[model samples]
Target: MRHFSSSATRTSRHRVIGALTAALLCAAGATVPAAAHSPATPAPPAGAPAGSGLALTPPMGFNNWNSTHCRAEFNESMVKGIADIFVEKGLKEAGYEYVNLDDCWAKTQRNADGKLEADPVRFPNGIKAVADYVHSKGLKLGIYTSAGTRTCDSVGIPGALGHEFSDAQQFADWGVDYLKYDNCNNLGVDAKERYTTMRDALAATGRPIVYSICEWGENKPWEWAAELGNLWRTTGDINDSWNSMLSIMKQNLPLAAAAGPGHWNDPDMLEVGNGGMTDTEYRTHFSMWSVMAAPLLIGADLRKATPETFDILSNHEVIAVDQDPLGKQGTVLSSDGGRWVVAKEMQDGSRAVALFNETGSAQRISTTATEAGLPEATAYSVRDLWTHTTTNTAGGLSATVPAHGTVLLRVAADKHWAAYPPAVELALDGSALVEAGRTAKLTTRVTDLGRTPATKVSAALTGPAGWQVRADSATTAAALATGRTLATRWQVTAPAGTATGTYDLTLTTRYRAPSGKQVRSSVPFQAHVVVAPPAGGGYLSDLPRLSASNGYGPVEKDTSNGESAAGDGKPLTIGGQVFTKGLGAHASSSVEYYAGGACSTVTASVGVDDETGAKGSVAFEIWSDGTKAASTGVLTNDMAAQSVSADVSGAQVVRLVVTDGGDGVDYDHADWGDLRITC
Candidate 1:
């Protein structure tokens, strides 16, 4: 579903937005240039610069790729239904205007008249009919095509690579208001020239159309597309996963200076309600996208979206930051201690700050007004956008952010007095299951939830008698700011003769708050230790493991997915450590196992290994005697290894199959670690 950026010259040329704006104004009423061939270009006529005044702000809308992925079910009726949801669900009122058709909307070939035709069966009333419907509903219609001979999806329909003018005219005649021009099968054509040709064609039609260049950031369009397009895709497609979402945000946030006003950097689409991440992560996703001024296109099934999704998508105050008249993308002020702080300069001289906790546990985050680009030591009033609560910050704001969450605030100068004390919370990230008499590691992350910084931060761990916890049971940490996190790991080992059962763990953290007061907090948790069975079988990890004997290829050590392919091999990382011993297979591909039979269950932790967009997308399935027993939901980059189990009693053979999740097999590098069959 994505075409990542290929190798290109690392050019660092920079062009200001004012220059591009001036170029558009200068090109008004100019004659468009003709292309080199029949499909390459069209005759010149009335023209202007590309995408001028069309995307003064990032365009908000709904795209259909993440939801259906060019299935046969995509048709005019589906478009109409989504258009209705745009209005009926109040999305249109929330500023989501464009109802875009991504791919597979056209016929395999042009009609006898040499015109692109809508699929007769799927779009009986034609593209114009759907456009009319969206317009009537007070929304714009967006269509998709490619700069290559075939679209990225290659749905059999020809792309607009060589038919710039003709396709532009057809789209204009159909009343299309936006075009998502993709880059697929382009045969090494210069991306800039190819897209510019269509830009001129659209402008020559004397119609206002938003030109969205979908080069997948391969050519660094952010540096050159300002005058050629309204918005350009800065990365590959986005999937519904926490890792994918956060990775995209991390990549786009650094390119903020490349965005402003009309020319925006698109980070694909939103995956808020796709069930890939928690609601907390969705808020962070929306908050990050808004702060970066990225397009806010919803990519979920709107007809059945939950209220939580609607609330996240329809947050007006957050939307205001995205649509700010200043049109400046936010900048990251700090990214230390698992806390990411972003500050966007508003038109009214105020700053919109987003404090994000990227840890897996709740953390206290704080920053002073000066650190957040506001006047230092000056009284300021803080408004929490999500909570809609206004409070006075003596110098800055602070709050305790949940795991993978964010706190959005609008800070302005005020002569008020309010002091929020620093607070600390602790969370542990490690396996709940531990091997008796063996050593295990657990990471403790402490977060500050007050407005001021906490100093003298240290932690200690205590467990059952005869148990040993090593590696800095008393560890010191750097000063922690509000919303910031400090992580420490402690190794715990039980006595060799200790009983196998659940044991309690206590983590006591001692710290000095901003007020110079010492405080201590205790967190009680549990870890289970299961001893190896005295007889026949144990976890495969305890014994020498064998690779696939059939239905697979070479088994390389430390390889998870595959190599140089969608199912390419990549290593598995757990708790930030690479687990070299595991199983890796491609979709429709399997690894056989003979770890003995008569076992009560087969268990293995599964997930994708790579972080390269959809190439790491896959579903892990376990099969016994040609029948499915256990499977996991589609795992992307963000999802960590999850335990997948199935009954295998009386079984002699079992296999792990990594299949393309009902879609064509692409990035199906599946990982199954600690694979075992136990009685």
Candidate 2:
């Protein structure tokens, strides 16, 4: 029963037609109540625990969301089987509890007594029977409902809306140990008020059920859910994919302050073993969730879970970080777009650090103990959580993380070494601009921040395929003194027949720490390498290879104003004609081209791109060696193409300038099509 915002497109939905049909028919035969049964004021039974106090740590359990999604296959037998497997497979012993159900279990309508009932087909023995069975196994039972008038998957069952008290009492009477309250079909009710009502209702029931608020963070539950529920979902539903998981993680990283003991900020349920991600990616997902102190709710089918799934889910080392007594959610200390270092402070003063690589290739990620809150220059015993290996070191730690993976380590201060790792900072220059068939010199500066000399320094460059990238300086050098900067340079030559496109280059540097251990760090740099296209043939995206200038708005490339994509994916279009580049911005945008005396006559079709409507005026000017050769009077943003030519017979350079015609630039998308220079 997952729902996305209106701005988002739904990629998939839970297919539970059979369950909905049965529930709907049952509701059709049941009676409808005229009024909701709500108490005038919510008053909890004596000795009821506060919502925040219910979950002292992020709850470790399993939910049916990702696996079944309330499909017809989700029934009493399936749930009981999961509970039995949890106990039999030692998951229960490993602290995995709470067999939870999502939506679609309830009938469409309430009984004559205004009590919601379970669908006979899916739960013939009713919810209480299932709860009692779960209790017999020493486990807990969880149920789901919506905060809105109808659930997200309201094909059959209605929502709690005005029946908060009655529903909470029913759950308590049925011995439900947990409730996953959703926000679907809320009918515009204020999220805070509606969720607060449920919180009070659960409290009044005198039951110690774990309350999970699922509003998809629309109303910012973390800002106010501290007293509203034990845990709160802080993002939309998670899909079983790498991008979805990473997006959720990115959104949750900044909300760590809103989480702690009792009130955990949940980033949806886990998707490990769901067959949508690789084992390495699953490990990254699990480790990140644990590091962030998010509730560990496995959403895979335990009945068919692979051994790898069990291994990742049962890793006690990672789990301990999630359940640390300090209750501090980890913080992202540093990130380079794809690589990140997240550190959590433990109660024992040791810090748990996760070196994460979100890229598609393995990368060396490193961080200092000081940056992660560990004492600087102090010897520490490092424990690799994934491998369970221990090492003693006083310097910083580095590890090669697999693609979409993490290196989780627990650091405890030791007194063995008096030395520290050389603090190294890496910098690169001339990584943004490159031309084909030419060798570009890239300069790298590495500085040592520690008093100890960094020994055996080396650097290497990895460029695109078919490209030759080599270091001009000696790859290996003698020890570098403290506070000294080692300037390493590399020359990269693009192939003579290389294609025109942006390429990624990686620079890796290795140096020995003060502890005499080799450490490595990598930084990614982009190279916009361009090769001249055949006469009259060029891509709009490649226009940056020449020169572009803007006085007000951005220089649009091969695209309409305000859009990232070209109007029809064409390469050339101008004032309205065909051109190689579609450059546009607000006030003034211009481009310059000098083909090294390759052409004497510059011809182009200029006009506004068809996609841009009439909004502003732009005048095009052609200059040769600082002299005006031709000018296209002012042209408005209309879908019409105009032909313009300028003779640069003996000019050394040719320039094209577009300016807003005396007025502010708004919706001004100018294009140059079929531009060419002929000698």
Candidate 3:
């Protein structure tokens, strides 16, 4: 629920180089320089209050900002109906307790006595009445206001800046359980002082109200807000898009040590059911947020929510990780290219491992129990939190994750290997690329990692419909000993006229556990069908990209960088020059095109787009195959467009990359003006 205009005054601040830049640069074989500021975990401020004993775990609830905003639908009836749905839909039982009201719930002005008043038309029965109703249902109520003189809404309702004590007293009397104090129109007051004033006011009322500091991390709230609020906003607002969520996750992932049992780092609210992203992406968002120990505030309208939304929100196993008693936030174990491995230590001696794929294509991401910080054991129980399935692993934990998807696993040391299926790791051993209608030799390797030997171990590879798969040799094994692998090669043929794209091939293995129970496990492999592009020369924008990912929003085609929505960009402009064609991308973006080893050169005039004026800086790199073919060291909006020409001859893939220029991604709108590839 953050609102800030482009012209709004804010103290100059820069974000620490987050995981996105570091990981992507590392993957590109670039040395990452040290950040200007220390990346150390910030210690809690001295004498930090222990909080109100509320929200010991990150709060789970619903906020109307993302779904309803300040619309008329967000009235008293809507509020009460949400509370009812929370009970009827089993959300309340699933540990979602708070029914929060966001901005515009109050009148434009304060009452005669300088006390804030709810809008009569919106909350006809008053906030206390709604609070009573929520409490009757065994849930708590939260209300919103800004720490400045006005709220975030355009009309600007009365804020709690100078009226903290009176407002806190009123909230206490009204049984408000949570206070989402925002930052807006602060008149340039010190952030710590403004937030700490409300903390003191809330405490003075002797009411257990959870304080959420919504300063948008402009003041490095994680460094000092721990003592002032239960949770602090770590980034700006989150729109319902893959880039937005992923960017925010990168921003929050580095501050793990600042979070604890009583204090949390809030990356805004959940956008799971908001409809902009696919279910796969939503699951990644939820899983990543849970692993980060962020608050699980449902930001979708529950009344109209689909079953899929509820399913993603009600995943109890993932929720348990968010609500773990130890309250430790997860940190990135490794991130390369678009694959990330994050692990969180649980209170029950388990480790929650999230294998996240942020690319546009499916990828095989792997990690080990030891890498996840699990103590050595004969076997480890790996439970898929999303699929609700438990399997044992000797040490390897891996999965082929779909694009923008996450596989959440809970790994724990287990001695009861006899009761569970033997851990069999399935992997593909050769190149996954095959020309359409051609046969590819796919090798399936299954390794037995359990303590006991497995009998009747068999494997089969199955592709999409109309595709044929035949084992090159015996696919069945009579017996497999511990730590032994059974490898089989299969001739997989794609049907003629098959589309050129990535397709899933399943590798299923059947074996008998020590208990003689037939156990089946299947792992997915991505088969890339490469079709040579027609010989041609054209603007890169007009060519179909193999894959594209932007750091801020979708990559713009022949337009200036715009907001999160696609097709919202303006004319492609760099400095004072406007072009009719090119790609407008944010920093930390990549667009891969199928060159088919035919394109001889890629040329572009690149610089920070004029859309961001003189505020942005970025570097443009053209990668042919896996090697850097051309690069512009760094270009700012004030600089003239720099011409780049990359020799991409014999390169199958040409990737256009924009980096944040080692400062930060803020305002890094890069333009590739008149970009063209010649064949």
TM for every model, in the order presented, reads 0.63, 0.63, 0.87
lDDT of 2 by residue, 1-679 (tens): 3221111223333222223210001111212111111112234454333353456778777888799876888899989999998898877776677889888889988899989999999999999999999888877888999886667673857789899999999998998878999876666778888888988888887677788998877667889888678889887678787756875787688899998877889999999999988898899999999899998888998999999999998887787788776789999998763579999998778888999976544455788777888877545656677766455444566665655788887876655323435545455742234567888777776766444677888877798788888777766667877556678777888887666555778777788876778888666555666544346534334443344444322345554444322232334444444454544433345465544344567776776555444455677877775578998988876546777888877664466777666653434456666566665
Top candidate, metric TM-score? 3
Rate residue 30 of model 2 by lDDT: 17
lDDT of each model, Cα atoms only?
0.69, 0.70, 0.80
Enumerate residue pairs that collide in model 3: none
The weakest ten consecutive residues by lDDT in model 3 span 20-29
Off by over 4 Å in 2: 1-9, 12-52, 416-679
Shift in Å, residue 573, candidate 1: 15
Write one digit per residue (lDDT tens) for candidate 3, span 45-120: 3344524455678889999998887889999998889999999987887788889999989999887899888899
Q: Which has the higher lDDT value, candidate number 1 or candidate number 2? A: 2
